[model samples]
Target chain A: MFCFIALLVFSVLGIFSATHRKFAKEAFDCVFRRITFRPCNTGFREKVRGIILVKLMKRSSFFAKVFNKYFELIAWIFFVLMIVSTFYVGRGAYNFYLYGNCNGVNEEGFCLFDPTGENNKISPVAPTCGLDTPTVDDLSLANTDLDKFFFIDNNSEDTVVFIGCYVCDFTRKAFPDIEKLLEKKKPNFYFGHLPVKHGSDFISSYDYCAREDTSGDYWKFVELMFTSDIENINDQNYLQEVVDKAGYDKSKIDECLADPETLASIEQNIFNIGNTNIYGTPLVFVNNKAIVGPKPYRVYKGFLK
Target chain B: MNIKKLRKDFYFLQKKNYIYFDNACNSLRPDCVVEKINEYYKEYPVCAGRSNYALAEKLTTDLLGVRKNIAKFISAKEDEIIFTKNTTESINLLANSLDLKEGDIVLTTDKEHNSNLIPWIKLKSKGVIHKTINSNPDNTFNIERLSKVLCPEVKLLALGMSSNLDGVSIPAKEIIDLAHKNGSLVLLDAAQSAISEKIDVKYLDVDFLAFSGHKILGPSGTGVLFGKKDLLEKLGSFLVGGSTVHSSSYDDFELADIPERFEAGLQNFSGILGLGEAIKYLEKIGLKNIQKQKLVLNEYLSNELLKIDKLHIIGPEEASRRSGIVSFYIDDIDSHQLSIMLDRSAGIMTRSGQHCVHSWFKSREVASSLRVSMSFYNTLDEVKKFVDELNNIIKILR
Candidate 1:
């Protein structure tokens, strides 16, 4: 058991040091013999034990005595700990690959791979909206009506519901990958703009009116809104220019923006998005699973049927 | 002797600050010995006794000078000293060269080092009989037992002058006399005893003696085998090469003189020069002083070690009998483990295991033992630290 632990530790240390390599080779031999049901040559174990006890004895003889007495039991404990830690490390790495966060999908915590939690970051919904921030457990796509939202029905069984705001940084970060996913998978995709950032509510209303147009240029308008400068996104003139650039009729969009029903419809869209218990922009549901931030493209594509 | 001043001569004692107790294995060389070795390589690093060039002639003169010094150290003629690799090789050379035919017997003590034991044991393949003379229960040489084994059929009485395992020396003079009386020639393995004890070959009247250079504060890979000039001339050359022969044809060769004939091939010039310097250094300090210093340190160590419970010393209880060595084993703790602990905790180097006398250990049914062999340069303070460290190890390990 001690040889097993020594093998793992010395093997890792052997990479950077030549002295440890000799011990690592000894430990490997000891382990190989032990697994074959032959008695382990006690030299390696005794040498390592003597070194440890000698070091310990200098600081405290009592501790050294205790350590020497329970050396086998301590080795067993360390072996079990090594196994458990290895399992958790393996699981963390797997989760980091699949979910973009070691803690799991839509969850945020410190990750060794992504130390700043950048993949799981989001532009939170303003407290001025009079809604409590939702926990990861509360985030769900259930009870959210998708019929009234702007969507592309591809007659595919896969459903992707993405809720974003044009002015939100995290949402803007996720836009290109989402566009790529929509183009490739062609799922029954829905786009819901909730306007989480300040001064971006009117763009949602403009988006609603543009989708109502027969030009089929709503996605282009949404892409322009996300990619454009944040300061210019809220300006009406810039918005109109973007609207024109996306090939939407200026007069028809302006008329739709002026209508009272457009405001009511945009408000209804926000209510529908809130029903998913979202507290941030760029909350995407790939079928039943909800991903909350700007995850890597593979993570979003991994959900496709 | 001023041990403090003597310790200054060894660079390792100053730099490593280790309580080096493994002197029986290899003593630390003084700066003089190291400089002598360097001098050979720096000045005349050429083949001795082979070439006619000035450098080669100078080297040949220097090598012969070393042979003379070594011979004088053991009270033998210059031609009687044959240079080999080590004590093992020296003994092997004699074992292979001796004119012992089939049914001839070789008798050795039970506590002989493998260097002495294995060479004689190997002679059995040539139809020579090898027999062991059991030592006393206290691991001392039994003269009575040796007398019983000695006879005309016993061609050689090969024995270690001192047991490296226990540091107990045989009464070489009495043993040699007894063996001669029974028509058996004696060969002494003096690897352990030659360092401190005075070995007067003329006084002891020993037929042959072997010792390693490294054990006597000299360079490794150097050893000397001293035999009577007539006896050396009578023995066949063990290894034949350039120096071993004066001239050779396709199928015939004229063997060189006694020492050169036994030396074979190119010798370790630097090591031989260093060994010569080591002998001079030993003479300056005097072997009697060295023996006295070692006994004082060993007596202190033995008395302190005896105070510990379940720790049994390997040889005689008297420290004087054990020379400079204190070999012991705890009841349950592994000697290797204890030795390692002592080294790690205090830089106290020691030897553990059978000390290459496997037959003795096997016969005693002992797993292993730790040996602390002291040298003249070692101080009383170093022995105290060793004892303290050993106690600490035993307290924790046991």
Candidate 2:
């Protein structure tokens, strides 16, 4: 009880010290008395202590005895704790005021140093792919038939292969950008459905839809799976609805789902993707240089140029 | 509890048909909370403190009324409650405002979330001492160790009321009593426990309490810091400027009273209004009922999860002790990969990672784990679906 009162009294005096020069001495005295296990000199602290003591006596003699025994010690501890917590809070607020995040980490956002840091904003400075050697022609696409993959456009000179799985949210969100890239540049963009078979069984259903949509309405199927809160993508009827919505020929989709060739092609894409050291989704390889996951439009423009 | 009726209140559950197990991260707002936020923008969009117009007066009254409701929720006076952007800021307010200097110490548990842990840990740079007591053998709070650490020298015990990682609730009342007895002030981080549990600050004799609104079906960027009025007044303002001062000259200024002294500039009026509505909704349901329902859901999830081979559940094995959360990791499968599989296969939303308690994870010698944290709106059917998906994921991935 003395501890709570001391903390309260010290706080008021501490605040008042800013305006009233005399209040600093009172604040110091309050803290000193509270810390050293001395009897609180102020009537406010004494009254609070007396009230708590009476309440303890009313409850039980044993309780009152225990309260009296630890009263000073408790007050000291409470006073010190309150003081430390106040400083700690002040420091954090200072950091937040200057750095945006409580800590100096710019990843959480709104940092004074980097205002656009949290958004993963595009850097105006041109970024290199950081590969030691340039190797676009070295990537063996001569043996592989491009038509077997979910080809968005096959006419452009520059090839931009988007290695992604439909089940992944990042990959699904990245499609609009990939679509824009294809429409603008007309790059030989192969929407490779690299269904990472090790992590998920549901990827197979997505792979099935990818293979079935030969007319390249595969993106429509991906959009349906991405947008709609469907539980099982592997459900044949549910996937068939996606295929129908994508405007794919019904019998062709069924034939593709049943075909061994479709599975072989998907396996080949995954195998190729794995060889490229692509462990995650929505990887765009523009002329064998990789740009991973939802980069801003300027990044693509930079690479395309 | 009438889950079917309660489920109707949450649009994401009813219309979207999502099995939301990510309540620990952020809860889906109910219709009333959304409506309250909308009302704030549509009805009175003016700043509460800066204006004296009729709409501004109404807005200010509504905001103040919300403040009263928040205080009532925690059994504190309105003046004691200070609004913050989130629990992180609330804790930071206490961290900055207090006059802790060299030789002072702040002791916390190993299982605290980053919000509670980081603020205190940062004080090490200022020459203030910071210490941590490890959890018990079963990963519960170690009372004996806490007692050993609690000396006259130790100033503060900053602890989470409940662990966000594995959902083990520490004995907060016992800890508070012990801290007061041993001369340490207590700060309870009620971020995870506030929504599901009943927390009366007066009953607990807690010196300080902080919690976020988003985890309680309210708007994002909303939080509360409850402090004893006297202690709050003592706290020096860290982020000052704007409406914090009453009157000012070129060099000198008088700060505002109690809560406003801490609140600084214009607040999140919309979010605060929404939080009030959210609290009203929770009160109608009763927090006791919410806690009871959570335990039932958690128990079913734990029992079903235990049957799976190669899967290890973290913290206490007892379902009741785990609160509304069940965190587990399989022997070889990556938790992030599993999270994706669960989402794609079952539409089950689960959080997977260090859970911002990286220190605890580092101590436990685990890399990552998947967590299914439920709220009252969750059903037995959802639990069954989650388990079935888990079983299927194990069968296929393994």
Candidate 2 residues lying further than 4 Å off, grouped into runs, are A1-305
Candidate 2 TM-score over all chains jointly? 0.57
Model 1, span A1-305: residue lDDT tens: 78989999899789999989999999999999999998774478888998899889989999999999999999888878877988887888888899888878777667888899889988887653565667768888778888867788899999888888888889999989888999998888998888887666688888888888866488888888888898898798998998899898788998999999998988887788888888787899899788989999989988878
Model 2: residue B41 alpha-carbon error in angstroms: 0.6
The deviation in Å at residue A126 for candidate 2 is 57
TM-score of each: 0.87, 0.57
lDDT of 2 by residue, B11-88 (tens): 888776578899999988999999999998998889997788999999989999999999999899999999999999
Q: To one decimal, what is the Cα RMSD in angstroms of model 2 from the true structure?
A: 28.6
Error of 2 at B36 (Å): 0.5
Backbone clashes per model, in order?
0, 14
lDDT of 1 at B45: 81
Report how far off residue A115 is in candidate 1 (Å). 4.3
